[model samples]
Target: MRKKKVLLVLLLISQFIVLAQDYKFGKVSKEELKEKFYPLDSTADAAYLYKSRRTYYDYVQNMGFQLVTEIHERVKIYTKEGFDMATKAIVYYTPESGEDERVNSIKGYTFNLVGNKIQKEKLSQKSVFREQLNRFRTSKKITMPKIKEGSVIEIKYKLISPYIQSINDFHFQHHIPVKKLEAQVEIPEYFVFNKKTIGYYNVKLIKESKGGRIGDTQYGVNVFKFDEDNIPALKNDEPFVSNISNYRAGMKFELTQMNFISIGGDFKTFSSSWSNVSKQIYKSSSFGGELSKSGYYKDDLEKILTENTTETDKLLAVFQFIKGKVKWNEYYGIYSDKGVRKAYKDRVGNVADINLMLTSMLRSAGLNANPVLVSTRNNGVPVFPTIDGFNYVISMVELTNRGYVLLDATEPYSTPNILPKRTLNWNGRKITKEGNSSWVKLTSSKPAAEDNNLMVTISKDLLVTGLFRTKYFNLSGLTYRKNHNHLTEESVINSLEEKNNLEIEEFKLINENLIGKPVIRNVKFSSDNLVESINGKIYLEPMLFLTQHTNPFKLAGRKFPVDFTTPWKVKNMVSIKIPKGYKVEKLPESIAVGLPENLGVFKFKVKESGGKINTICVLQFNNAIIAPQYYNALKDFYGQIVKKQSEKIVLVKQ
Candidate 1:
């Protein structure tokens, strides 16, 4: 009986293995078009039946050895929600060498089952569009025709690139589940590239060598193939994850060195070390070269510096001047789009143009200032040395009293030493004009703090009246002002009232326009929903509207680290006046809980004195980031916070 059961299980397993379709271009099965839903994942709106990418070298006489990448994808739309899968985008790079990447021979087909016959719809040229993302990147987009439920869409395209250093990356998993994925890279024997793999999926790698001839020269090609089956979709629903792309199962080829037989078999490096990349960027005309053109602003800068004797005053004046003149065009880049002088003249430029001008003015004022290249939070941290590692730049000044401070003028509400939260990813590369560079920590040493004071009275009718005052300090203050400055006063008040379910009498924001000052908000509110009366007994949540109702961490297990970006602290004090002739019945016990290693702390205390209730709560997060192992502990900590905050005070009729 045991032998018979084992044989039956083996047969079932073999049947399950045959479900994945073969990854081939223009191969669409009628069964795929007739399927109502994906069996592997019924909750998935769409599924990639088969996807494959092949990148190899194609020798062209005019373009030399150009890189060629071909992609083939087939997707099954299970429902109306899967219609978005019919639209596809191919992104390519354009370098400063004036050689750009191209996408050609794009073809797409949509298959649908109509009355037991396969209906085919070909993608038209009108459905294709070309969009330029930036100075260095472009995208080709196409939308398939006749997309509906139970439809199968197949797309194939060829990408030709002149830049060999940018081999492009391949992602096995996407927002939609994938049944099978295959990626191959063919590199010449003379070229050496370091392959980087990230995420939780294990890939099967196969390597082989082939001989190829270009003109009279013969060379060897090394091919590496990676295959992955049944890759689940990577969801970005997790809170505090740096970037979903960082955790996606993918592979990238970074060119480490290249030795070409046509070039005398000498190994030339594209990017070997951090210092080498720094020096190369500093030599570029769009970067360090633009900093040397301070002569254009020498007169204006010298006048500003001469008026201010001290270094602090001079630096502040220069920063203010540059910030007031240059308006960032909402573009993040480490290199200038337009030259610094031209950008200064235009009064509108990218991040690099604005910060490079700040660095130049500081240099003209004889202050020690340099440009720090940073990768933004969405860009993810660069684990290796490459020119594309950094995406943003900020000015750093050496202070006599406090070592150094980072400054970004991209935001109008941003003060010196207070960088925007988006740029606080990891350590940045601080490069000077003298071809020197070093790693600078991007973490803030100061904690963002918030304090709240509440004075309230609960009436016998279950209505609560309150006056609240809140203060925001440091980055918290900057964030508050930046977030609320654009909205009107009435709109802001309405939003606050709606969020807390309160009727506001008056609201005032103080110190919003003052730089380096704390922001204060004073509000007067009344709410009838504060307490519920049951059988002549009143029950009310002590923390009231200030309570954190939901724990942000909800995943069963997290494979990536949680990034809070900045340490923070919050303090709340509430004094409530009980109704006349009412006696205290039940009070929540005082609770104090902290995370391991003092990473975070939460405290709640309540006391009844002089016929009134006073509650003090403090929450502090000392670390900006924590490992995945601490996820459950933090989640439990937040759970405790929610429970304690929701603890009610029950009072019977007296």
Candidate 2:
């Protein structure tokens, strides 16, 4: 008991010392510049020495409350890689119609040690620039002056906005280590907000209720504060993550309800449930409104669905008709641009304009169809009940006695139940005509498959010439079409030749334009790099250019789930014809490995028959997502795969 008390006292003293350190915007200490590496994470190239943010609502005489946010942060660079840390980009929403956020009072300084003295450089206005991220978002980028290794930089800025409901999400952690962190949020009594937290790291914020005055008006206030030290950086670039920001340590505020206490005690509630949010979005003119208007494409749709006899046939015809009629404009939004009518007339539109039209046509054909609101892979998953949850929309049809099928008209090559990879994030909200909605899985039900067949012949000159044929199915097919459809055959051949360091005799791509069929690619190539001759023996990898030389899973530990996008399989069949005088002396042993709970399996087999070497390698993963608990096992699984594929087939002259 006595030892515990001593330790508690020492911890308190240490915290007090950290709080006593000077953190003023311009008062950078030499101790920060003298630091060569972060103690918490030595691998970190840079670290946040201190960061502070305070957000509150400010009231005016008659203009109502405005959101005010203050930001101040100091960074220490330990290496040349950290020099990029000096440039900061702050993004803000800039809708076309509403009041937009404005940044002001931007100031920064870089402090470095020179001749045992502190030298400071002020940020230049010329280095500050602004650019539009999208139609509704803008970024203000600032580059600190005199940034180099062993330098400390500090920045202070204030953001003001009239949209109180648009409270910016606050992140307590970053890609670099943080030595000190402080954050506070103050809300008035008239407003109520619900907070959602994400990521594995958690920080407790103290909450308190108090009273404050706003120009002769006494109002209740709620304040949340967090102060901490030594926060390790989060590794963001984990393999197969849909969006790392979704797994970042941060907090988001959603306005649940609001009341004007002084004005007759009137109140209003935002989306309190997913059902309520869905109903609100469904009734909007932009989404459901567009679905109801189909006069523009009525004739074209009818002509296409006229010859179809079955419901499935009609559905497929309508989907294909929409894709051919309307092309995507490279934009993503749940709301229609103008309307489905205008989009059809123009022959181009955003995601909503295309998919909503398909839904309308399906419904008109007496089929049960609805629009599924999706937050694409890049937008992250929508975990809360808010109107801003989804950024894309797709069509879903349910037959009388069969399971539903998802369709995306925005993708020209998409087929029923096989959506483009961009829409395969997690789940989407499907809203019906009855104003009801339900969550539907957005990931593909079918697996992405790749089948490769190689026939190889070795020359006495140590050159490898072969015929390679590969086929892609389901998601694999869609990926191939999306990646190479825009490139010419010559460009495609050149790209393949350059990547593999080989000379191509002939290249053929088949079924690329067939929507639902597998895409087949066959190439005839010769390469001397595929085999290595040590002394009088020949050695080559089993898969040749197809071998995975490096493991994609490299993290020592991972908190995020491993997302494969979809269940997948790869099958390889290779037949190697040995040289006339060569005899097989060695072959990699056959092995089979399976992941826990049948998540994945790999089978590698090789045999010699009639002077020809035959190898069959099959790898299949059953699940699109594996929990973080299985990360180590997944890493080990991939490690074994890499090791096996890299094993050489040795042959020598008899």
> Scored by CA lDDT, what does every candidate get?
0.86, 0.88
Top TM-score model: 1
Best by lDDT, which number? 2
Global CA lDDT of candidate 2, please?
Answer: 0.88
Question: Across residues 349-442, which tens digit of lDDT does each residue of candidate 2 receive?
Answer: 9898899999999998889999998888888776688877788999999987898999999888788888988888888899998999999987
* lDDT score of residue 398 within candidate 2: 90
Instruction: Identify the runs in model 2 with alpha carbons over 4 angstroms from their true place.
Output: 1-20, 30-42, 77-80, 83-87, 109-135, 141-153, 214-217, 259-263, 307-309, 488-491, 532-537, 652-654
Query: Residue pairs in steric clash, candidate 2?
Result: none
What TM-score does structure 2 among the candidates reach? 0.89
Tens digits of per-residue lDDT for model 1, 288-345? 8888887878788868967897888988888888889889999889889877888888
Q: Ten-residue segment with the worst summed lDDT in candidate 1?
A: 13-22
Q: Which pairs of residues clash in candidate 1, taking residues 3 or more apart in a chain or in different chains?
A: none
